[model samples]
Target: MIEPTMELGGPTGPKHRPGTLQNVVFAVRGQAAELAFRDAVQG
Candidate 1:
């Protein structure tokens, strides 16, 4: 299977990209886990 590439320039005047939903969720979860671990270690 072939993947699509972002157009350098077009009628829309380039695409505005953002992080994937899964990545955003993972980042939040990871930060929460890190904070919990730190709290456990300190307290």
Candidate 2:
């Protein structure tokens, strides 16, 4: 039930682009997995 938000690169250089959909998806999934692992460890 985790709702991830997309982060667009601002005027602070061009470290992050806005057209990489696959990267966004992978990032979210990695974050979700990390969170889940932490929760399981705590529980």
Candidate 3:
């Protein structure tokens, strides 16, 4: 399962490429969780 990556050119293997649909969802979920954690700690 080769996939494009930002670390280097070409599809090296399984990876989360920036701007891809999967990455977008993962980034959103991660950021949401991070913000929730921050609020829990600071607020």
Candidate 4:
């Protein structure tokens, strides 16, 4: 799931403009951070 998205982000061509790919990356990273934070807090 995440691997494809990251791979797609490898090339910052015209299609992967500033906000487009960056937003997806940020969303994925944010979800990961939230999950990690939840785990840490639970622990």
Among these predicted structures, which one has the highest lDDT?
4
lDDT (Cα, tens digit) per residue for candidate 4, span 1-43: 2543344434543255656766677657766776787799999
Count of clashes, each model = 0, 0, 0, 0
Q: What is the TM-score of each candidate against the true structure?
A: 0.56, 0.57, 0.53, 0.55
- Candidate 3 lDDT tens digits, 10-43: 3331263644776656555656666787799999
Model 2, 1-43: lDDT tens digits are 5433233223321255545776656666767777798899999
Error of 4 at 3 (Å): 24
User: 1-43 in candidate 1: lDDT tens per residue?
Assistant: 3211112222222234344565456556656666787799999
* Position 8, candidate 3: lDDT: 36
Ranking by lDDT: 4, 2, 3, 1
Question: What does the lDDT come to for candidate 4?
Answer: 0.60
lDDT of each: 0.47, 0.56, 0.52, 0.60
Clashing pairs in 2: none
- Arranged by TM-score, best first: 2, 1, 4, 3
State how far residue 15 of model 4 sits from its true place (Å): 16
Position 20, candidate 3: lDDT:
71
Compared with the true structure, model 2 gives a TM-score of 0.57
User: Highest TM-score: which candidate?
Assistant: 2
Model 4 clashing residue pairs (backbone): none
